[model samples]
Target: MIGAAWRRTLNDDRSYHAINLNEFSFTVPIYAYQVEGEGGLSLIWSRPNRD
Candidate 1:
């Protein structure tokens, strides 16, 4: 099984400030022979427009 999740952070203006993420999680049967690897994970941020 494979899955992903996400989280969001708010700024002082009560707007979206940044997005946090978790890498995909996988589950495999014991008999299945497989090699697993991971890549760089990152967070994206944006500034809120205050009018």
Candidate 2:
């Protein structure tokens, strides 16, 4: 499981904030999507335990 937070500032003195959460198995591929006029998203994965 993973969590994230986001914030954006516009040139007109406007701002926006958002939050997201993600869950996936260690053996599966992850995917993400962003809608038009919405903010962006970032995905990060860590290597599984080797032991």
The CA lDDT at 15 in model 1 is 29
Among residues 3 or more apart in sequence or in different chains, the pairs in candidate 2 whose N, CA or C atoms overlap within 3 Å are none
Candidate 1 deviant stretches above 4 angstroms: 1-39
Give the alpha carbon lDDT tens digit for every residue of 1-51 in model 2. 475656656687665544455556434333333323445544343444435
Global Cα lDDT for candidate 2: 0.47
Badly placed stretches (over 4 Å) of model 2 are 25-51
CA lDDT for candidate 1: 0.30
Deviation from native of the Cα of residue 27 in model 2, angstroms: 13
* Candidate that would win on lDDT: 2
Query: TM-score of predicted model 1?
Result: 0.22
